[model samples]
Target: MTTPTRRAAQAGSGALLHSLFRTKPVDRIVAEGGQGEGGELKRSMSLLQLTLFSVGATLGTGIFVVLGEAVPRAGPAVVLAFVLAAVTALFSALSYAELAGTIPVSGSSYSYAYATLGELVAWVCGWCLLLEYAVSVSAVAVGWGSYLNEFFDKAFHFTMPAAISDSPGENGGIVNLPAVVVVMIAMVLLLRGTSESAIANTIMVFLKIGVLLFFCAVAFTAFKAGDVTPFAPMGWAGISAAGSKVFFSYIGFDAASTAGEEAKNPRRDLPLAIVLSLAIVTAVYVLVGLAAVGAMHWRRFALSGSEASLARVLDESTGRSWPSMILSLGAVVAIASVVLTVMYGQTRILFAMSRDGLVPPVFQKVSPRRSVPVANTMIVAAFISVLAAMIPLGRLVDATSIGTLFAFALVSVGVMVLRRTRPELPRGFRTPFYPITPLLGVGFCVYLMVGLGGVTWLVFLLWALAGLAAYFLYGRRHSRLAAAPEGGGPPDSGKGAPAAGEGEP
Candidate 1:
């Protein structure tokens, strides 16, 4: 459908130039949904299952680990930061709902960009997504280590030593063994298959929610009006900065969109799951942030407050250890679930790319009995486990927010493009405020990216450069769209556009 261009015969500057601007026909992608020659994944997830997947992915480390770091930036006004970030997330969520409802395929934002934007931009989106999901998994895994250590100290009366628990250059440690172990555990579970993983995720979600509610009940008992005095002490600048940092918490909602092909009734359920998960997580973050701040003064919240900060707050407030001990268990469970969801997101994204011939076919190979991309999961798991075991948590999180923002911006743009290009296609969900919602989604995400600083920008540019090199060196010549015969596939598909995701915050 794309004029049947092949890199083998046109391996010249002409091919290179064509690679940059070459676009996939919307119709061809639409056909990929029904009776695709490329082999389809089984659709088994319902709306409830999809929602649990999203919530499980989103409600993990961010609220548990990020609050302590963010509160110091905005003081009591970190509550407002959560609110602002949720608003920012809603705009993108609406766009994702539109695209997911329209396409209902496995690529997420990468798929949407390919159908509406072009191949090169799609490659870049997928590349940025690699940073988002991989780093998120690593970062969350590291946080998991902290929580696991905390749980041992609280319930078992002992803790892992710094040498083996912390990452390189942190507290005199070289690598995080717990982090590596958690990541591998997730990999094993994933290898078992998607439905098995989904059920595990659902159980974890309920456990996490129950624990947060318990914490809230305990925290409000210590609430004092005096502590919240002088809210917004650092002013709007601080609130904005904190908002950018907390934005990571809202990224997991897109995980639902990544399961587009595997979701039963994807067109109807994907958008619902995306929106519902965002709403549920936003409420949880706001309530948790509010309760924690009310329980203790904001200045006490710092980087040292990481891992078991909420538990520490409860222990200090009630002069009891049992509350903190319980919270430690919750954090451990929550972080594990996040690792699982994030790793799942990365493998599925790679699987979609492989099926499109943008990457090696090994990633596209599905297990005969399990119906899962076992090889893809292993490759992603190995890379993330190394990153989790080696890198400091802070560094791992730096590129994730910026990468997610860039991907979200592109998806917002894609929504507008498709609205104009294929206006006749029925969308299951549409963004309210028309162009304004998407415009705000793009503008706000860019603003947050700017807030991340020059160092992050330089790192992202370097990463983007590496992705581009890989694309030109290998992916361009091997792309399925570039080699496929004309008049293949359907008009266009958007029921569940697999997406670019940063895992649970």
Candidate 2:
């Protein structure tokens, strides 16, 4: 009884829905791990290197600069905010650990979403990851410039001119040259190869940890019980708001998961690295936050600049320039390590998406000699450099937090979906309490996302819209899964197979 026009409309709608929710098989995702353009990604990262990579990425800027910003909002209760953020991150970290052990792919949450959720959700997760990593590197690079200027003033009695050191429109800055310089430096190191970069990150991670401990030792010398009084001055609302803000600090704990294909023992190492790094980072952050608040009144942090908060705290605690100088030096190394590891994570995510034909093929083109994604690294560096040179840090940070929370929420959902759909799959690690843990992860992520500013939500919505446009325009048409025959995998590209030595742990 239906006319041809109505029948055609129904058919078109059905086809669109089918394409939107199509899930990629987990086995296919694993089998396609190392098949890139020129060569496969080399697996050389040990458990120590993987853990250090996450530590290197997570330990920067948030404690160094964001502490100052959060303190005014929550008073001494900023310490509680750090703990709350860590708790939020912990729930999701457990989910990430389970999935990383089971999947063991370079795509991180994006690949997990594809294997469990759908193509549309996978693209959205990947796009959010792009926002999280790229903008976080830019934000960290901006913080690096502040410390670099502090180091210059301390060691040489000189600082770069405001025009060249600050982002556009801040302090009359035309460009943040130091931020650009750091991004380029990270790019060069990434081109060298993953193992070489991890080695450098390990050294920097230890140095920064030493500096933070030194900060705590000196800061405690001036600790007063009075400063920590009235800890909940603004009550639970203020602590929750600050928790959302400080959540930016916890963004990089998943950096280890992005290296799933590159880890020497991904099944065991990825989960261990993820959980260990979060524990280590959380302890350091809580210790530093307590020390900072106890050494000085929370209100005073506003008078001092937030960009170089730790150095200023050290300066005040000791009434000496040398301590601040030491802190500044450590911050420069600390933040640069962040930029390096986060940017590496970004390139690998793009590489995975590219392999699925969701982005340009250049992303998956591994360098034959170095076994790194040279072109992908360069592209990411160039884009991040521009952002660091142009955008203000405050705008960059909140936008990054929202994107990260959204991605984390999706990852939590993915864990539950995979468990229900493929309970028989071998898992090297399993989430404790199963549905309850992942459900709490999703709940915490949503709570924080709601606490973020309305402007950040608007920015995230616009970003999601842009991703949808890109996906429909290019990704949907060229998707490998879409082109495959029914109940079959995509045709082999004949690039290369996964490297030997990968096996269940």
Candidate that scores best on TM-score = 2
True-structure RMSD, every candidate = 5.3, 2.9
TM-score of candidate 1 relative to the true fold: 0.90
Worst lDDT window (10 residues) for model 2?
491-500
Give the TM-scores of the predictions, in the order they appear. Answer: 0.90, 0.94
Off by over 4 Å in 2: 3-8, 230-238, 393-396, 487-500, 503-505
Q: Write down the lDDT that model 2 would get.
A: 0.89
**Residue range 58-142, candidate 2, lDDT tens digits:** 9987788788789888999998898898988999999999999888889999999998889999999999889878887898898
Among residues 3 or more apart in sequence or in different chains, the pairs in candidate 2 whose N, CA or C atoms overlap within 3 Å are none
> How many clashing pairs per prediction, in order?
21, 0
| lDDT tens digits, residue span 268-360, model 1 | 788899999999998999899899989998888884466567877898789999898888889889989989988888877777787777889
Compared with the true structure, the alpha-carbon lDDT of candidate 1 equals 0.83
